[model samples]
Each structure stands twice: as structure tokens, then as C-alpha cells.
Target chain A: MRKRWVIGILAALMVLLSFKKERLFTEPSGWPEAVYDFKRNPPDPAKIEIGRLLFYDPVLSRDSTISCGSCHLQYTAFAHVDHRLSHGISDRIGTRNAPALVNLAWARDFMWDGAVNHLDVQALAPIANPDEMDESIAHVVAKLQKTERYPALFYAAYGDSAIKTEYVLKSLSQFMLTFVSANSRYDRVKKGLDTFTAKEAKGYALFRTHCSSCHTEPLFTNQRYEYNGLPIDDSLQDWGRMRITRRSADSLRFKVPTLRNIEFSYPYMHDGRFKSLHQVLNHYASGIQQAPALPPSLQKGIPLSGSDKAELVAFLLTLTDREFLYNNAFSFRGR
Target chain B: MRFFLLYLLFSGVIAARCQEVNVRVTASFSGKPLLLESFYQLPGGDSIAFDGVRFYISDIALYLGDKRVYTEKDSYHLVDVSDEVTTHFRVSATQHFDKIVFHLGIDSATSTSGALGGDLDPGKGMFWTWQSGYINCKIEGRSNRCPTRHHDFSLHLGGYSGADLAIQEIALPVSPGDIVINLPLDKFLAAIDLRRQHTVMSPGPGAVALSKTLAALFEVSR
Candidate 1:
């Protein structure tokens, strides 16, 4: 009789646990809290579905041929893999690469140069660019409002029958904010659920010594712009941050990218100049360009030996979250 | 075809309302027409014709027959000035036509926030990506003065902090008889000169001057 009472109480506790709301965004253990405030537009299933539909819809483009997914593919963890620079409608080439869209809720700014400060407005950059989507927000809003389906969808999520830019953008951001990649092998090791191999442990130590200042641990990015001794390309002559500041000191200072999935997010950096991880390590080891403005860490070379490079590469591969990459929740589906 | 007909119908409705108010703004010149890459200079030059001109206006409140009818939220607008299209406005529902209030460009909060679309997109070449601020106002055109060829000029003017704050609110009343409510090229360029200050691109005293010039033009006629 006593055993039956205990069993009944335990089942009741299980029922209670199942009813708890699953967090829309969660901080992985041992990681810094996410930078995005989910409270602004809380996670709702309907809103995320609407955002997903818009993300895959080519109607946002001028010629109706390209969508955000055109450049950012789900197969490549929402990154453009075939080419370095992004291609827009009519095969129009852009100046920068379409970066991977993982863990973006933690990002403070958007674009390689950190030009866009707010996440809600990031979609507008590609939508309005003459060489990108080439459509105005007003024009896009009008287009969506004219559509018979979109108004109802917007109405379902937002209490208004009229679809506006804020709801469209904010909902899209909600879906993007849902992309969290914190279940990697590295994370497991941090959680003590698993142990790193001898090579991975050694590699992690080398990474800590050489890469952690800029590409910090846990989340794997300090989120600050830095100049890692890269020579200016003659054709583009792109001065990364100088144009924003008008101060010569900020010239060529591009935003430091996260190395969370560095094994797959290759052809790295703002320009996509390097094609392989071996080449990236080589640049850090010995090819660091000398400049008055280079970051302090690369003032001298990273000075890694050939074996050390191999081990560092091995450890970076540990950062790849296969489950996150293959997750069906982020896959593209025709709405 | 039907949309065009409706638009035409609405245009006349707006015109009649403006006529009831009888407000007019002059197309005067303080120096020369607001030149590209430069500021106001002495007048008496060749005709200043513009190819493309665009700016924004916000906070539109309309009055009807003795009562306030409609008003817009923030009410920002991008006014494209060329030879073809001119004179646009909203109609009031009420009978009392008395006053209107508005501002040019983005408000203070909208200006400071980062990475926005619409009138604030960087691709428009209006906002500076590196500096993390909007150009606020952009006016550029060819100049036939003692400068460079084509006299390339840009007005990348905007600021949010310090003494260089760009946002300002202005209110003007509706006057009587055939209002016209013309934001003509002449009225906007009254304080500008092509020869001396042909190109005033980017922020400084040049943008503030243009803003002040825009404020005085909203004169209420007796």
C-alpha cells in the first residue's frame, strides 16, 4: 500500500514536468547568456512558422527568383557553400560572403564589418540592396498585404489583419533566434558527460593559448572586431571598419567571427580569402601580414608547428555539432 | 487600371482640402541653389535644374472642418524631387482645416538604433556603414562652377549625440484659399548656393543650414 502511494506521487511529478514550457532559447551550461532578449518577441509556434515561410519565399526578391535561403542554404547549416561571395537574383554577385546563420541571437551586430547593429533590421539590408534582393520594405510590405494568404498568416500571429514590416521582421528574427548550436562534442566534454581524446585535449590547450583571446571558448567568439594581419585586396580595396569610423586607426578592423562550427564554415574571414582550414592555420602560423594596426596576438606569428596545426584542426572538428546541422527543424520546407 | 483611377480620385480630394487651407511656401534663394559638395553662395547664376532629389518628412497631423481628423504615426516619408512628380498630400475627414505638424528625416530614437531598412538602408548610400550613423540627408547634382567636372557632391549628413543632433520637430498652420502646399525645389533650395558651396555631402554646418532653411519655408499665410 505504501509503495503504491509513492508510485502515484512520482507519476504526478512526471505529469507536472511534462507540462512545463520548453524554453524558446536556452543558455548552454558553462556558456555566457545569449545577447538577444527573447522577451521582446517571445517564441510562439505560429510566429516561427510564419517567419520560416517568409525566409524560404522568393517573393522578397525583386525578380522573384531569390530568397534569403537562396544564399543561406539549410544543408550547409544555413550558409552559402558553393561560392564565397553571395549571388543574388539574375546571378548578380555581391561583395561579401553569406555567413552561416547559427547562434545569431548571441551576435551584437550583423555583416562582416559589423555594419548592422540590430537583429530585427538585418533582413532589410539584403532586401533593399540594389545588388541583393533589390526590393523596398514598403514595397515588400505592400506585396505581402496584397497576398491573400500572408494577411491571414500575419493575422494568425499578430492580432492585426494588416501585415506590417515590424511583425514580418520581428517574427523572422524569432525563427533565427531559435537556431542554437550548443550540443557539440566540445559542449559534452565541458559538461563532463564525455571525455576528450589525448589529441583533442592537447589541441584544446594549444587553442586556448593561441586563439582564445579573440575566438574565446564555450561560445567560441569574443564578438569584437580585430585585424589578424591580412593584406588588403587590391581590387576591392575594402577598408573593413575605417569607412564607419572615418578614423585611420579603425582601418581594416573586421569583426571577429565565431569558430563554433569552423570545421564546416570554411573559406573563412570577411572576404572568404582562404579556402581551407590548413590555409587558415598557415596564415596564423607564419603568413600574418605586418601592419601598424594588426591585433596584439598576431604581432608575432601564432608560431604553431606542423603537428600542432594538425592537432588544432582536430580539435576544431570537435566543435562541429552534427545534430544541429542535420536538425529538421531548421530545414527548408515549401509553405 | 482601377488602382490608378482611385489614386487620381484621391489626388483631387487632397488638392481640394489644401485649397480650403490656403497655405503657400515660396521658392526663394538665399545664395545659389543648394549646390552639391558645397554650401550657399551669392545668387545670380544660371538656372539650377536637378535630376534626382529625395528627402523625408514625418509626423503628419491633418485637421478637418473645425476638428482634428487624422494623424500619422511617426509619419516619416522619402520625398523624391524631380521634374515629373510634384505636390502630394493627405486629405482630412473632418470639416475644420486649421493646422499640420511634422518633422523631416528620422526621429531621434530611430536614428541612433543600428542596422535598419527602408529609408535608412546603407545600399541607398545614405547611411555610413563604418561610422555607425545615418547620413540623415543626401542632396547631390552637377555644378557648373569653378570646381571639378560634374561637381560630384553628396550630403551624407546625420548625427544623434553631442551638439550635432539632427532630429528636430516643426509645426505649421494651414492658411486660406488654394493651399497648393508646394514643397517646390525653389523653397527647399532658398538658402543654398551652387558656386561657393556647390557640394555639401556628409554632416556638418551644411546639413544644419538645410534643416533651418526647411523650417522657415513652412510659413502660415494670413
Candidate 2:
């Protein structure tokens, strides 16, 4: 019995010591542990600052005309506003909308089609896409290596003057991983520090009943694909998840995006079809097109009264964490 | 005195069990030495000049008869026809190994484990930027039969999913001492219907099918 007790105490001590280790991000109360393996890529303030510099620099693009910050701006919750589809270098139009970069540490896959399985490698897609940056990682590495500023920054972060692909990508992920948006009004309400208004409370109830299945709470996403009854665009016949899986059953299924900061990250959906929450609610209420792959819950259009729609919109607005949207720390650092 | 005797006996056994074994892989086209940037005739009577031929082989295991003898940890290798330095492995010796088993492509774990260095580095031209995964094998050349610009035929085979998994496990017989595994490119070229589909630069059913065919193109000799 004494030996067993000693072993138990040792195990408990180990668990405590592990918790005391440096975390990539703080786990918000009642939130699930982030999917990102913090143990491998531990967060460091120096690396985060370096990533911040890279995020805003247009040098990552082929012609030095566009940067990651071109689409992902801070005030707009890191989503490109005023464009249905994201605009890239040389006035090139991309096929899909750039989703908001909020709570990315909890994401299992990146992109609307779930192409990038790991966050560390996700930047490769945009950096190489012809419509986007149109620059290869090798070229980007060479560019960073040649830069007078980046070499020292990389050395400070990684203790090496030689800038490599792993350092570049991990640093970008490190910065993106720090974007935690858990201080919204809903969070405060959940913590009993504040209370929701009657309309927001009603909206919350309606959201739990209808929308919470796919857009689960806390993270506001179940991190899975679903056919949400949006008709295929005429010009761009993007068979969403099927493009990745090549399965007929997965056709038209796109990843369920987080509802956090929905108010600012406008022109919503994979293609940014609905520009407002009212239009989205209307689409859910009466605009669902009948399809074989459509989720059963969304097949029979959700019946929502005008008042319920208003209430649901109010609740969605509560998710807009102003602290996150206007966080000066995420803004562009002048080179 | 007895303890010292046992310790000496065990020390001798340990030393015997941990000798260094070397494995070398060599690439060829139609049983002839594969020379980069040299022209070679295909089965379809078309002369093909190769510019590059690189591929990854990982997860090496040695078997003595039916029982497992040795398995290398973190065993990923990039075999480029031009770069002879990468086609060698120095592993701890086993009691005996009659057969050597290895995958033709990187396993899913290493492929999805984010950015890597050395042979698997993206800068090495074996990685796809649009999609995150290592190109298991890359065969680029200018063929007379190719109808496209510059008559180039670039085939990059890699994927990591059901029905699209590109990694193929292959086992070949081996004897003691320095081992050389021959990968005859003609065997892979024999199965390719280059006329119909030659330029495969992305992951899909075509890449997966080609990876399986390439996996069978290896032969081990003493």
C-alpha cells in the first residue's frame, strides 16, 4: 500500500510539473485542449515577434506586392473585408474567401476543403498559390536569408543565422497560434461575470437548438465537414470536400467555420455568398436547396420567425470580441 | 569470480550483437547504369532523356527467416540518381538478416509531421507546395513521344489517404556484408502508358497507381 501511494504521488507530481511547463497558448476556462502539439513547438515571445514581422511583409510574394496581412487584417478580425472572394497579387482573384484566422490552435485542418492537415505547413498553400503570393518556399527562404533584418531576427528566435523552411513555417504558426479569441461577451456570460440581454438570451437558446450541432460552443466549430445546402456556383463548380477526398458522399461538404467574430468577418461561407447574418439566417430559414448530400438537419429548412432571426443575429453579435478585433499587438510592425 | 565471468561473457555477446552493417542502393535504366541527362530508349521505341529521378524509401526492417531481427528508427532516405551520397545506410548489425523490407515512400507520420530537414526538405524539390506532403518519387525527362511544351514528362507520385495512399512496402532478399539494392527503371517504365498519361504532377489515383508500380521495380543481389 505504501509503494502504491508513493507511485500515485509521483504520477500526480509529474502531471503538475507538465502543467507548469511553458504553454503555446493559455487554455481558456471550459475549453478543450488545443489540437496543436505545443510540446513540439513551444511558444517563445521572440519567435512570435519575428512571425509578426513576416506576416505583414509583402516580400513573401513573388513581386513583393502582397503579404499574408493583405487579406488577413487585424481590425476585420483577420479576414479580408470588402471582397466577396479574396484578391491576391496583381489583381488576381482567388476562388474562395479567406476565412478568419481566429482560434486556429484548436483547428485540426486548414482551408475550406481541409487540404492542409497541419497548421505548421498551412502557409505553404498561400505562399505558392499562383493567385495568392505566387512565390515558392525555397524562394521565400532565399529572400529572407538575403534580407538584412530577418537573419538576425531568426537568429534571436532560433539561435541561428541560417534561416531554413522549418524555422520560417514554425515561426508563422507560432504567431498564428497566439490568436486566441475567447474573451467575447458570450464567454463572459458563460463565466457568470456578465449576463446576456433578453434578445441575446433568446438567440442563444435558438442557436443551441439549431446551429450548435456543427458550430459547437467555446470554439464555435466542431471541426468537421458537412453539406450545408448551399448550391454550387455556376462558374466555379467547386465540389468542396470531394475535391480532397474524391468520394461521392463527400461532395459539396465544406468544413464548418467558427462563428466567433462573425459580425466582422463578413461575406461568409466558403464562397462568401451571404454578406450579412440576416441573409445567412434567411438562407437557413427558407433558402435551403434540396440535395442528396445535404445534412438532414438543414434539408428541411429551419423554421425561424422574424423575431427569432433578429434574436439569433443579436447573439451572434455578442461573439464579436472587440478586444481581439482591435488587439494592437497583432498589427503590422514597420520594418 | 563467477559474476565477473558472466559479465565478460555478456559483454562479448553485446559487442557481437552491435556490429555496423551497410546497405547501398543503386539506380539503373534497362539494367544499364542510370546516367542523369542521358538519353535512353523506352519500350515504346521512344528515346527519353532524363533530367531527374529522385524518390524516398523509409521504414527499413531486417528479418532473419520469419522472425524480425532489426528495425531502424527514423529511417528515411532520399535516393536521387544524381546524388550518390543519399543512397547508403549504415545500421547496427543484427544476428542475421535474410530479407530486407522497406517502404517505397515516406510513411504518413513523417509525411504529415510538418516541415522537415535534410533529404525531405521542401527546398530539395521533392515537396509539393499546394498540398503538404513529400513527393514519394519524381521522374522528370524529355521524351520524344511527349506532345507537350519542351516534350517534358514530369511525374511526381505521392498521396496519403485511403484509395490514394502512395507509399508501398517492398521486401527483398539480402545476404551478409555490404548489400546493394538495384532499382531497375525499365521495370517501372514498362508499366507506364506514357502516351495516354505522362505528366502526373499532383497526388491522385494516377500518383497512387504509379507509386505501387514503382515499388515493384527493386531487386537485391549479394
Candidate 3:
């Protein structure tokens, strides 16, 4: 009886310790409420870990040659910088650049075209894209079920060894929800913990004047599709949001991406046309393409001199959160 | 012991009052039952064979006159012609209903509400991966009139937004008994020209138009 009591108490203590060590999703101070409905699929440490594993696993691809981490590297703030268009399995080139994955909990829609309405189903796009993973969600679930490690992991996360599409998606969402990057120099300055340099301060002022309307603060995006006045690419002819909405007025409009990690997430824009921030500024300054439906702010274009462009670049660099970039928790872990 | 006996008696009475009505969906070519991969004569003198025919029926509610009498909880059914088991489902009704109302496709809200399970699950091949909406109805076949490669045609109807919303609510009056819903394939093929509009895999005007036609094709029988 005494031995049984000791074992039961030890088991209870282990449960308590596990609960204490479980990682949680935290909303950064002064940030708005997350758009994600956590009540539907609440966060669990085991589920998040399962998602992290699945994110790094190449089994999601047809040939197991590529993973989400392949395009979205942790060091680059989860955005691929090596290619203009995202290269998929078998080196197949996609149409648009892979946008950086940061503060996704606040995002209303996913993808450059806003094709995916919810984040839970966002991974479906790349997984089933012919140029990307070239695998279906059904096939991925089947593959995971056959894996010895996945059954155990899924059992721990979802309390069932049988893996389904819902569990796979919800777990991935849980892991991504933990990807909170609110420790950047700019964020610190906002919190009164640090101060921005003179150039950065000047750039911030300039950003508020010209760019902050679309790239709003606190989240760095207003989350609306706007026509940025880029002349249509002759070869691609991608209509952006118009393809999804099927409206003439929505033609050439794309979702405004978050400018949180602008330093590392290079090769910018929906198609990654501009290689540098200077080129982007130059586009705004004089290269705004003439269009009938262009927003008033870009109609005349922001007349920014070379010095102002330099200052903007300096301020953009302050948005980089090195802690998020180098965070080991998000990095690849071997099973 | 007396209270338990009384409770059991009350539950039995309640269970007896709730009648289980089986809903059987059948795809018919003209007046005859349709079979998959079997060639059938079209009105245009063209031969056609259905490779697949699947659709979603959701929000099933029974109505007495204009008022809803009973609504099935989580009422989403995937009726796949090839899989006869999926074509039949049971609903419990406490009272009699003259009209059966249901949406021919998933609603806009449910389509946008992240990963769903069961018949609405993405694994069922009903949900579109490239886009976020569910493929409300899928009809893939080969018609001799089709000009495509291998004389094939695929129509996946779905879109839950603005001008492209494809879901159609269908209400049919019926007698008080098990319901048998028939989708006349002849009428559907008669409405569309195979050569000009064979492939419609995306959510657009084609999908919405097809959905509208398909919605009107549902007929209820005792």
C-alpha cells in the first residue's frame, strides 16, 4: 500500500511538472487581439511540437525532398531570400515570392492573392501545389499514418494514434501561433525599453507620413489589398486579388505584407521584383506605373529624395528581431 | 428503483415519438436510375458516361407549411453515387413535415471556417487545396461531344464569395415518410454544351451557373 501511494504521488508530480513546462501562446503587450479563434482549436504543448515536426518534415512533399522549412527558413524570419520565385519540389518555379511568416495570428488572410481565407487551411496551398510539394492532404495523412514516429507523436498531441487532416492542420496552426516576434528594436523602442538612432527616428517619421497608411503600425500592415502600381509582368500576367475575386476593380491588387523583418526577407514585392529596399523606394518615388484605379497616395507617388530613402532603409532595419531569427525553439529539430 | 423505472418509461416514450427517416439520394438519367461508367444516350444524340458524381447536402430542415419543424444537428451529407453507402443518411424527426429544405452546397461561413472533419473534411476530395472553398459539387465524365483530350469533362462547382457564391437552397414538398431525392442527369447535360464548356474546375461564373441549374434539378419522391 505504501509503495503504491508513492508511485501515484510521483505520477501526479510528473503531470504537474509537464503542465508547467508546456509552452503557451502569448499576445504581445499593446498588440490587438489575435484574429485566430483559439476557442475552436486551443493550444497544447504536445500539439505545437507535433506541428513543428510536421513543418520540418519532408514527408509532406511527394518525393520527401522539400518541406515548409525549405522555403521558409528560420534565419530569414521564415522567408526564402535565395530565389525571386519560390522553388518547389524538383526545382519547379512558382509564380510569386514566399512571404515571410511573422505575426500570422493577426493576419486575416493568407497568400499574396488572399486566396486562403483562414490560416488553418493555408498549408493546403503549398502541399497540393503542383510546383510545390505536389502532394494531397489525403496522401500526406496516409503517409504520416504509416510512419512509426508520427503515430506516437500524434497520440501524445491529439490522444489518438490515427492522424486526420483536422489534427494535422490544427497542430500546425498551434505551432505557427507561437511564432510571436515582438522583441525587435522598433518594438523595444515602442515599449520604452530602447531608443532609435537619429536616422531611424527620421525614417520612422517619414514612414508615418508616407507608408504607414497601408503598412500600419503595431502590426505593420492594414491587411487590405491595394494596387501598388507595378506594371503587369508580360510573362506572368498575374492579376493578384482579381483572380480570386473576379472583379475588374480588384485587378493588380495584392495583400500588403507585414514589414516586420524587412532586413532578412529580401527580394521583396508580390513577385519579388525589387532586390533591394532602395529599388522599392525608387519605384515609389518615380516608377509608379500609370493606372486608372491606382490609389490616390500612389497616383502622384511619394516624392522621396535619396537621403529620405536611406533614412527609411535605416528604420526598416530596426524592424528586424534577431531573437526571433535565432530562436532555437523554432529551428529544425531531429527526431 | 421506482424513479429509475419512471425515467426509463419516459425515455422510451420520447424515443418512440422521434421517428428515424432515411434520406436516399439517387442520380437518374431521364426516368431510369443512372449507373457510373455506363454509357447513356443524351438528348443531342451524344453518348456520355459519368466517371464520378458527388455533392454535399447541408442544413437539412423539415418544415410544416412555412415554419421549420425540425432541423438535424450538424446536418452535412456527402452523396457520392459510386459509394452507395454515402448516398443514404438517417435523420430523426419528432413531428411530421410536408417540406424538406436543404442547401445543395456548403454555406459561405462553413467553407471559410478552417479545417472541418467528416464529409466536409479536405481528405474527402471535396475541398479545393489551391483555394480555400469546398468543392460543393463534383461531376466528372466523358461525353463523345466533348472536344477535350480523351473526350473528358470535369465540373467542380464551388465559390462562397461576392458574385461567385454557388450554394443553392432547395425546398421540395413531400408526403410524411422517408424521402427519396433524384437528380436528373439528362436535364443537367441538356442545359450545357459539352464542346464549348466541358471543363469547369474552378469557382467562377461557370460554377455558379452550373450550381444554379443543378439546384433546380433536385426532385423529391416518397
Whole-model Cα lDDT of every candidate shown, in order: 0.70, 0.87, 0.91
Instruction: Return the number of clashes found in candidate 3.
Output: 0
TM-score of each: 0.73, 0.92, 0.93
Question: What are the DockQ scores of the candidates, in order?
Answer: 0.12, 0.72, 0.78
lDDT of 1 at B71: 68
Question: Which candidate number maximizes lDDT?
Answer: 3
Name the candidate, 1 or 3, with the larger DockQ value: 3
| Model 1: lDDT of residue B80 | 53
Off by over 4 Å in 1: A1-22, B1-42, B49-108, B112-156, B159-165, B168-191, B195-222
- Under CAPRI classification, how is model 3 graded? medium
Would you list the rank order by DockQ, best first? 3, 2, 1
TM-score of 1: 0.73
Task: Please list the residue runs of candidate 3 whose C-alpha ends up more than 4 Å from where it truly belongs after superposition.
Answer: A1-23, B1-16
Q: How far in Å is the alpha carbon of A291 misplaced in model 3?
A: 1.0
Instruction: Encode model 2's per-residue lDDT on A87-135: one tens digit a residue.
Output: 9989999999999999998998889989887898898899889999999
Off by over 4 Å in 2: A1-24, B1-18
Best model number under DockQ: 3
What fnat does each of the candidate structures reach? 0.15, 0.72, 0.85
